[model samples]
Target: MTHVVGEACIGCKYTDCVALCPVECFHEGPNFLVINPDVCIDCGVCVAECPVEAIFDEKDLPEAQREYVELNLRLAQSWPLITGSKEPMPEADAWAEKSSKREYLVEMV
Candidate 1:
């Protein structure tokens, strides 16, 4: 199964995971990143690269974060593809440790 980008990624938006993805399945939103389920290779390489541990295999996703599967799919279709590394949000370090960030998600670029 494909990997899902969860709430921890909402404001952090670290691109370390994006650079490790062989298929370039990542999509860039205003303040987050999503994996295009159709394009993801399920390589699992991006998992450890994530500073906030936001990436999870579809089958291994936490119960509370399951909705991110659909969120990733939906947003990936509309957001621009992100194939390389980039600076994260200015407050990424602060946001990374904060919980319940889904509400901060931005649907657009």
Candidate 2:
């Protein structure tokens, strides 16, 4: 299983999680960050570093954010790994607020 990024991280896109990630499982996406489940060591460092409290253990994820479990993996596969500091994607705030109503919350995996 992998940790998931929830809605709170939408506009924030804090890289603290990325910095603390031991395996660098976090990847940059078009509008948000994704976690590579295959690469995640489950060290839980990223989870703690997230300022918005968007990260969650797969098994402990709330139902509202359950889609993020798959979203993380799918987005990570196609998106590139962003090393060093990352800038938050533009319009992340708008996306985050609407993600709950998005037709495709999680890309098909």
Candidate 3:
């Protein structure tokens, strides 16, 4: 199964996971990072690097976090993969500082 990024990652869109991803399966959203389940090799490398412990194996994810798995895969289907690192993007802390636990809002979208 694939790993999912949970509510804890909201706004804390750290690129550490993205950087460690071998297939470049991780994608960026307006406020967080999502994994492309179709492309993910399930290496678990990105999960280890997440400072917020937001990543989870699909089967291990909490019931509340389940939607994130679909969100990741849904987002992956249409979003482009990142090929290179950029400069001075929003830091995890910066995003975290302003992030709200908005998992419920995702359903409204």
Q: Cα miss at 38, model 3 (Å)?
A: 0.7
Q: Pick the candidate with the highest TM-score.
A: 1
Candidate 2 residue lDDT tens string, 1-109? 7687776675456677887777878877544677888988877888877756778889988887787777787788888886656655576556445545434343332
Clashing pairs in model 1? none
Best of the two (1, 2) by TM-score: 1
- Evaluated at residue 100, the lDDT of candidate 3 is 47
- Per-residue lDDT, model 1, residue 56, is 95
- What's each prediction's clash count? 0, 0, 0
Q: On a 0 to 100 scale, what is the lDDT of residue 89 in model 1?
A: 94
What TM-score would each prediction reach against the true structure?
A: 0.97, 0.77, 0.79
Query: Whole-model lDDT, candidate 3?
Result: 0.72
Evaluate all candidate structures by whole-model CA lDDT and list the values in order. 0.93, 0.71, 0.72
Stretches > 4 Å off in candidate 2: 87-109
Q: What's the residue-level lDDT of 62 in candidate 3?
A: 86
Pairs clashing in candidate 2?
none
Which candidate number has the best lDDT?
A: 1
Q: What ranges in model 3 sit over 4 Å off? A: 84-91, 94-100, 103-109
Worst 10 residues of 3 by lDDT: 100-109
Model 3 Cα shift for residue 42 (angstroms): 0.7
lDDT of 1 by residue, 1-109 (tens): 8999999998888999998889999999999999999999899999999999999999999999989999999999899999999999999999998998888898966
